[model samples]
Target: MKKKSVGIIAEYNPFHNGHLYQIEESVKATGAEVVIAAMSGNFVQRGVPAIADKWQRAEAAVRSGVDIVIEIPTVFACNSAHNFAEAGVEILENLGADFISFGSESGNIEELKGIARVIEENSEYIENFISKKTKDGWSYPRARRAAVESITGASAASLLDSPNNILAIEYIGKISNALPVTIMRTGPGYNEFETTEKFASATAIRSLINENEDISHFMPEEAKNIFLKSEPVDKDVYFRLICHKVLSADSTDMEKAPAGGEGLANKLKASIRMCSNLEELSESLKSKRYTRTRIDRFICQTLLGIDREKKTDNYIRVLGLSSNGREYIREVKKSETCRLPIITNINKDIKNFKGIGYGISVDILAADIYNIAAGKDLYRFSEYLRRPFCE
Candidate 1:
């Protein structure tokens, strides 16, 4: 009998017990024999640096039962929700995944499906939404939620407010349009701050780690060990790099950065000199039209030199894979549907791939540079981190 496979798009900054539960539930729901995770690299969707590198995170996923881990290029990894969803969906499709699973606050798929339909159709509500936002100076997300509430009379305001629900809706929208994969929903909110009755947020776990608090209660034993053994790069270093780029780079160069638009370049250039840290710069630059996350992503893009218009997923950068994952890759290798080459090493040739984005390349380079600056040779140590499925 053939085994079933499901793909999970994630950034396992530190794979916790909740993540383990989600993986278990996804497998149970989908009856998938294999779980392929398209995970974010050194950065995450919220524009903050990931606590762990891709390889370490991938190892955690594998240890927790993920069959294979593919890299969601940093360009998409650090962008807005919609693009992140699109990129993840595209990668799953390329891998010929049969289903995609994600966590959500509103586990009601029908509600998400309805919202997806509204967004897809570009319904009259969206136009009214834009108009209302233009008048009230609301952020895009806030305006969209307000419009949905007004047009549907369904009290979608609460659903729209939850970050996990927002991403879940985007995932549904992405799958609804072209992908043939089924969807599996999980419990818990992505941004939940406190330990809930059954689930805790990744954000809370990271906060605990940042404050040198005990996270063993939240994370798996293996995950806690990984986090303890590995030291995270200084957040200040990356922030300073971003600030320097913003202050020194020409407007034209900054304009080409990912999420750079609508005079954001000038705003960032002006704000970088005034603010001292990433959080302060974000606060200074955030406007009613652009959210803090969006500005943070733009700063990351500027640091990585990502050109938004030129972004593409041209390679399947494998972070880790289990035995089952290796088998799946072997099966897919024979199919014409898998277009991008699987890349394991960065120093090797990749320039032949056309759709490879500047952001992705720069991100890889930056990670290497980050490793070197911190006095650790990442290239040498990166391979040791990669383990076989069984460890």
Candidate 2:
């Protein structure tokens, strides 16, 4: 009999104790022998730069119990939640994963499933609920929750409001349209900043790290070590890039930027002159239909110069996988179902793979430019630091 495999999509930013708990619980709950993790590279899905390099984070996942680690192509890694979830689901489906394990605020699989069912069915109650809420000028998420509550009662509304729960629903949305992978969720809100005995949000940890404050109370010992060893690029570096793009590019050109649409380019063109930072630029662009996160993703797309229509999963870039991960790859090599090639080295030429080549090149260029802007040699350092799964 073949060994069962589960997939996890993560940023691991530092891979703290909370992450470890999720890994352990995933294995216990799914009873899978192998776990394939699709993680972000130097940048995360949230459009923020990661503190640690990708290889180190992958190594940490392997040490913690993951069997395989694949890179979530940079194009998807630094986009909106919907795109992020779509890219992850695409990789898991191609990998022939049996299940996807994630951490959610609700933690109650039944409640998440209930929400997923409503989304999948697109019931009249949900539709009317969404329409009414949108007419009132509420954001889609807030409105959707209100709609769910109107039909399913307050409990459902409360569950959908949690940040992690929203992500869980998105994950389900992607999975429903893409693959047959089962979902196993564990844990509390990803936005919770306060430290609990077992749960702490990545946002809080990142904020503490950014402020140079004590994070020992929130992270696992291994994660703490990794975080200390890593040096993250300053946020101001990205801010300046955004400003440059806004100042130099014409309104028409800004419209060409990823996710820039519907008079947003002109708005950004005008707003850039008025706003001093990325946060403010995002705020200035936001409206009833466009949320802060959506605006952030657009800015990130402009920074990376990714063409939204061209996004696709063409190859599997290996960040760092353990010996076990390598063995799994070797086993899957014989299966025709696994169509995408595993990229072991960055220098190798893969001309035939259009999407993969574009994704990798874009990421390398972004890292290179970001480093130059910051007066650091991140590209050169990344080449030396990056290692293969078995290495």
Candidate 3:
């Protein structure tokens, strides 16, 4: 019998205790023998560099508990929640996953499904409402929440207030081939910087890392050792690069950015001149209509030269694998359910990505740039030189 495989969409920025809990709980809940994680590479959805690069993070995840870790290409991984969730679901489905799991503030899967259904049913109305509200100087999240409230009532709309709940709704909305599983998120909130007895938010862990504080208690021993040996990518390291991109970019060039258009390019150009640092620059661009995350994403997209139109077909690019993961891949590849080409090796399997080169190119570029940001020389074709981490 084929073992049940469950999929997780994660950005294990440092593979903290919370993530470890999620993996264990997800496996317990689903009875899934093989766990696959589609993790963000180099940069996360929040539009900042990860604490460590993709390989280190993936290795930590595999060593901790996850059976397999695959890279979520930079284009979708660093974009909006919808894009992130949709791409993750697609990749997991392509990998022949029987279930998709995630951490959420509300672990009630039925409630989440209800909310997703309502949102899908009212998408057009919500979009129109969002358009009207944005014109009235409201942020996208606030507008969308209000729109949802108008249709589903305040009780249901309030669910979207939590970050994990928001993602839960997106994951539920996007899943077609796999079942949805939600593990109740414990400890501090998503962006919370507080440390609890057993769990700490990734935000808190990253802050601790940035401050050179001990995070030994917050992460698994293997994950901690991996993180301890590596230098975390400092967000400020890319500030100068961002400034250069913004200053040197023409109106056309700015419009090419993933977050560009609607005069935002001009706003970024103007803000870059007066701001002394990345935080100040982001603050200067912040408004009711544009959240800090949106601004940060724009800055990252600009820094990496990722454009709005550079979409690519989805492909599963494995970053790390455990023994069970290798066996699972071997079995899954022989089955008709595996819909996408799985590239375990970049050097020899680069040909499998012929038509889907755009996403891979973006990932390579992001990694090379991340190397520079991490104070490493740009090893030409680093993507090709690196191999997937195997247990």
Candidate 4:
């Protein structure tokens, strides 16, 4: 009989104990013999550079309990939750995963699926409402809440309040071929910086690392070692890079980037002149309608040249895999349903491709800038030089 497989979509910004627990429990709950993770590359959804590079983060995940780690290209990785979830689920489905697993605050998959169903059924109405609201200076999240409330009442809209629950809905809504399995999230909340007995949110872990505090108990032994050895990318450096990129870019060009419309490009251009760092720039641009995260994402989009109109073919970029992971890859490749092109070796595989799309170019640019932020060697075409991690 063939072994069962489950897929997870995560940043693993730095793999933590909570992530390890989720992976272990996902296996237990689903009876999955293989676990595959679609992880963010150099950038994360929150519009920030990951503490460590993608390869190192993938290494940490593999060292922990994850069987396979594939790269969610930077274009989708650093965008809104909807795009992030869509890209991740598409990758897993194309990779021939039998199930898709994620962490959720409510843990009740039924309620989450219900929300997804409602939204899907009323998608046109909800989107039209949201469009009108956003045009009236309402943030997307608030507009979405109001739209949901209009159709299903406040009770259903309230479900979108939790970050994990919101993501769970997106995953459930986007998933077509794979079964959805959600593990109850424990420890601190998504943005919480507090530590628990043996678990801490990735946010807390990053904060602890920044403060040079002991995070030994927060991560698995092998993962901790990998993190300690790698240099965390400096946020300030990333901010400065964004600022530099905008100096040469005009408002018209900046408007080409994601979320850079409605005079935001001009605002960003002016803000860059006065602000010393990212926070200051975000604050200067933030208003009742525009959020700090939105501003930050726009800034990142500009730096990475993320044009919303640019069409790119999505491919599965495998970063690392354990022994079981390798066998699973071979099995999936042999299956007729697995049609997505898998790139394990960058130099060899990428060269054969006809043309790289804007989405992929953004990923390549992301790596180059990530190395700059992390103060690593800046070899030209460095993406081709680096090889995937295999254990």
For model 2, residues 106-200, the per-residue Cα lDDT tens digits are 66767787887776686686778777776676766777777777767887768776666777777877773332333333333566567766556
User: Model 3 TM-score?
Assistant: 0.97
* RMSD (Å) per prediction: 3.1, 3.4, 1.4, 1.4
Q: What lDDT score goes with residue 215 in model 2?
A: 79
Q: List the candidates' TM-scores in order.
A: 0.89, 0.86, 0.97, 0.97
Off by over 4 Å in 4: none
lDDT (Cα atoms) of all candidates against the true structure: 0.74, 0.72, 0.88, 0.87
**Clash count, one per candidate:** 0, 1, 0, 0
**Residue-level lDDT tens digits of model 1 in 102-147:** 8777777788778778777876758776776756777778778877
- Clashing residue pairs, candidate 4? none
Error of 3 at 69 (Å): 0.4
lDDT digits (tens) for residues 1-391 of candidate 3? 6789999999998898999899889889989999999999999998999888899999999999899999988988999999999989999988888999998999899999999999999889999999999889898999999999998899988999999999999999999989999999999999999888888998999888878898999999999999989866556667887877788878677678777666888898887879888999999989888999988998888887788776788788999999999998888888867767688877677785576688888888898888877887676538988888999
